[model samples]
Target: MQVVKQLNPLIFLAPLAMLSLPLGAPNSITQSLALLLLAPIAFIATKSAIKKPIFITILIGTLLVSLFQVALNPNKEYSVYQAIRSALPFYLLCAIVVSYKKILARIIAFEDRTPGSVQKLFDRAVRVFATLSFIQTTTFFLGFSLANALSQSENDRVMIFQTTSIVLVFFYSIIRRNFINIFLTSIVIIGTGSKAIFVATLLLTFFAAYSRPKFSMLLKIVGGTLILGGTLFYFNPLVIERLAEFAINSDGEKFKDATREYEIEQAKETLLENPATTVLGAGFAMQVSHGVPSLDPAWEENSKYDIENGYWGALVKLGFFFTMLFALSIAKGLPRDEFLMAILLVQSVMFMKTSYQLFAYMDGVCMLLWSICMVAINKINANRNSHQSQFQQSIQR
Candidate 1:
């Protein structure tokens, strides 16, 4: 309880969104919790972004267009609620979180004032989350179920938030060449069957280790690739359970996500459906449909959008101009740290798979944003400690 209390407001919404379990770490529950945290977040962000006019303008533009977008929607009642829930994650990042350079700077300053308080809280929270995630993964592998991992489909589980802290450890293990953590974290991540997360982690790990390019690093990469390739072609447990989806699913077909191409075509049609939708954007929960027979099994109804692709997702919702503007706005807030930058770089490629950056799943957005915050805390403290050590050594001399 005290550990949660010790969390700096900058990272508060993140943990709150991730740990929100009623919806089983899905977007709905996380967004609901994020909405609850918005008031305090907005208060903090107002103070934090006082000097950042771009952020203020972006917020204003979003609200104005969103109001217009909502009014234009035929299903106003549901759309109003849908729009609010979808955007809450974006609103709740009030470190305001997207302003990474400034927010991380504030966190560093807090560390200076309080010594090790925030870092300790962060580490402790991550340990708890990582353990829960590991247990869930283990349970899934052992032919059982826990919580809501298999609620949607046999092999499908969205544990992005739960796996996020562990991904940070996975990221750091590559940086430090810690084989034990690298192996353990790898299993938990891949077991979740998250293509975006696993691929992002693997790519970043490769880039970081490639900088050194030792024999061992190359050998690790080759060995790892071969193993993964083998599993994919051979006895992959992750998908083995998916066969059960057909037998148990009422639809009498295996539940599956729409292909990225299918989602893209549907989104394009919806975007160009009318001049108002084109110019102002479709307000909240706008459902796109096609004549295709198979449907997104996760949804109660088949309303698919190309939201898995962050850019395409935004384009459908906010039009070209606003979407591009939002993109630029995010660019302004990206971290300057090389390591953090590398993670974002990989995710950019995988945006076609999922959008953890903007209004994807609240849990994932919270998890990833929280993971970045944790990385910043650790990196800043380590650098400061190193400088302090050097200064003491100089004084002794």
Candidate 2:
């Protein structure tokens, strides 16, 4: 019984650890199957945790939207299997986060009793994972073809794992005020060559510093940002070039105006052709099958569907009403802390470019953030309660 109790935390950590596995470690199908299998265990473990009404509402809303889509678009080339494949990871991740709430409290209580142990464990794990990722990234940059040796899919998987590790370490360092960890993790994140992650990290660091607003914290933030910028500028100039290219393309230039005009025209035609789909979306499988048309010929050639924006993708998959409800649910579920709000804002921006909500790896990072925030809140409340108890005892004496 004691051993079983001890292992309960692992139920929550298993999916996260699985997510951190290198691309060569497991194929995508196997990794996905592993997460699916873990979902049931998570559900079973978290059965005792209190369920939030907002979460239930979101889950119900998702189901209703899916059902309505299926019912209304019977003639559309929709696949129930494909929809489940796309949606299950999200639902399972939700369950894991909800269930881990209780387990996290317990872990925190244990950490309070054993000072530095939890931090040490996390630091060791992060250092090991981040080191491996750094090595891989450096090898790739040195023209070793290590990353290219793997298939494109595998390479993407590896990068996702590395990115996830960097995010985890980054947040952990922020909470613990571990500068060394922060410096090392930032290097790995920049090495990934993802402009979005770079921007997200910077945003998170700024918000974290702003939350406290101490002079020292401000100095560290400035110093860290400069170091990151200088390192990237010297070693990986392409990141800056790509970001500049994106900014130029996104500006209200003639090309952008033309592209926007063409997209709007195509969208109007689609809505007119399928009026009902305008309300509840054309469903994922259908949307994928009949690709969303794009004004940019290059974009269309690159991707089957040119719905690069996550909000637009949500509208395509769930329609306006359901998308609104989903957004509301997320808003209601998030913590009120400014730091957390900043993280969510960063995540929201990334979601615009890609469907981060549906990806298990990104979801895991979110869950980690949620857990950290909840634990910090709990600690604060506990301290307050302790102070109250001491004051009451003094008054009685």
Candidate 3:
């Protein structure tokens, strides 16, 4: 028991460390292996806590849907397999959240001992990665062969870095609002060349700032935005150009719209062909190849055309009812805060252009945030109880 207590913090760090690693190389493998190792520990730690009925229902429902889909659409064997693989981590993370309150408390205790330690670590990591990315970008411009091996492309690196940073900012913002973290994270988001993420981050920033509605806080936000904007413009003028490009009707915008329309049309045709499949989803991996082709050949196999839109992806795999259940389950599980709600709303919009499965690495980061919130809430309640007890005792005396 003592040994387990000593190692508890390390378990939480495993996911963060895995997320920090380069994308598509060893990151996925390491995360899976770590989860496989940690699952038993998490279960042992929190098994005594009363299980939430809704989580159980959702878990069972998702599994049943996967199985039903597999049975009905045996041709989509690989799709079902991939979907299950993609979803397993999310379900596992939920189980960890439900059972690992003790571990969560331990992490919170560690944070209390060293205030801002997590945020500092996150900032340092982002800086290190960003520096490497900048060097690589510079070298590529200079026509250096070493640039290829130095770092991932700016677009890929920013996406990975920002995903990790957003998780940190989300949790840190909840604990203590800091403009520096938000500013740095915004820089990372802008580096992605993703207008949607930039807009989403902007909306989330305003939502978080307006939550307090203090004059000083509003001033800081405005001042920080100006500094951040100017710094980006001075250092990387292209970022400003990219942001400006979103407003204009360009060939890129036309191509993007055409692709989205084509994909939606194909989804409509596929659903119409087999109306019954619309209920539970043509059983995970029932491919509809009538639309846009995937650049990744793995997605092309088994008749699946990589659905970029998350909502459409969910609709394709889980169908209407299960999708609602899944969405509700996620909503129920998250910490109740307007900031978080705004973040989720923004993510939902961003998902229209990208695919983010529930079992993805970003979900792991979210699970950590949820655990931290739970610990904070518990502490607050405990303090309230203690204060009330003391008051009552004094009155009686």
Candidate 4:
């Protein structure tokens, strides 16, 4: 164990964290290979006391959910196998981030500093985070481009990535005051053709700008109004058409009609037909029978759309209880408003379409959430100690 620890410590783990990039590119062999490389790093980095409780709780919860799903699933062999494969890496990554002492210390140091130091540290942190965000987003888009170039398919990767990119852009906008990056990011987000993301990004930007008193009220109002108006006018019809067609039919709609209404109606029926399934859910791999094709269906399928909505998809697979727990985990894990808002926007975008690829994986977003939690926990600990020290001094006096 000592030899293992020495061979695979924080320095070795850094690259694994780096490799957890956002690109949803199709490379099964590469992903497996990367996992092999990260396994040792994961082992070494995940060795801290503070993170142990968090890791244990999440692991236990996940295991319980998986165990229940396996027992209930009619096709247990395949479902259990796939669930473990998909979930274990996320668990390891969470543990690795939590146990990494040096990273934790640095974050605690930054958070416990004076105001001027905090500002400087914040700037440096923002720059680093923004760079990481940029790398992930760029790699994802490039992967999509490469895949499409090879396969001759023009379909975008998914909606959530676009929304995540917008969130990152919003953060960068706050720090750099570089509207060009924001503008470019806005364009890339729009390129995905996700209506929810487009609207969420607009609102996110407006609120972000409004949060600060530096901008005049009038500028904030005007800027916000313009964003709202542009999105409503430009993106509305296309998104409405796409979504409407997606809801009712098993295939995506060819043209815009009242497809969304029909799809919602169908989803309601599906839910009503399976009341028992509602509480505990249909099981992990139940979607294969829900009419969504293994390959992309030409038409919209209601169940297919659910996969795109992270909140609902989890509910359908893991049960209502687990879904609620996971949601709470996300909330507890996010410390800052900006981070929470970013994730919320991504979730909203996810809810608006059929994008399994986007919301399914735990990647950079999970890492960020864990980091935020570490900082929050560290800060709380520091404040408690400070208060205790003051009390002791007063008693001595």
- C-alpha RMSD for every candidate: 6.1, 5.4, 5.8, 7.9
RMSD of 4: 7.9
Task: Output the number of the TM-score-best candidate.
Answer: 2
The positional error of residue 130 in candidate 1, measured at the CA in angstroms, is 1.6
Model number with the top lDDT? 1
- The local distance difference test score of each candidate is 0.57, 0.55, 0.53, 0.46
The candidates, ranked best first by TM-score, are 2, 1, 3, 4
Error of 4 at 134 (Å): 8.1
Clash counts for all predictions: 1, 0, 2, 9
Candidate 2, residues 1-397: lDDT per residue as tens digits?
8756654443434344444444434334444545564664556533642266545655676677667766776875555655665566556555544544455565666566655555455445556655555665666555444431211222222243435436645765775677776776776676666666677777777776877688987887788789889988887665686567666665544223343344445444444456566766555444332344556564343233324445555666666666675566545544455544655655665665555444323344334433453354446556768999999999999
Quick one: how many clashes does candidate 1 have? 1
Cα lDDT tens digits, model 1, 1-397, are 7543244445563444345232345445544555555455455555776567766655666677667655566573334444655565555543354555655666676676677766666655544555556665656656554533422346544353445545656666565566665565666666765555555666766776665578887787668656754664364555434435423555654544446556677778878988767765664555544424455554423234325566667777777766766567566766556555565655575565654455634544444455555666767767888999999999999
At residue 64, give the lDDT of candidate 4.
67
Instruction: Tell me the deviation in Å of residue 196 in model 2.
Output: 1.9
What lDDT does candidate 3 reach at residue 182? 54
The lDDT, on a scale of 0 to 1, for candidate 2 is: 0.55
Per-residue lDDT of 220-267 in model 3, one digit per residue for the tens? 766766776677667556645655664554755532455655766666
The parts of candidate 2 lying over 4 Å away from their true place are 23-41, 44-57, 96-106, 109-120, 143-158, 162-165, 250-276, 292-306, 359-397
Q: Tens-digit lDDT track for model 4 on 1-397?
A: 7644332322333343344344444544334545565555455445452355666665676566556655665552434444544465555545544554454444455445422343344434433444444554444455633221101124442333223534554544543465554554544454445555555665666565655546564474457447644764474344444445444444554433343344444344434445555654544433322344435442233333345444445455545655555455555543445444555555565555432322234343333433343344436455768999999999999
Worst 10 residues of 3 by lDDT: 145-154
TM-score of 4: 0.58
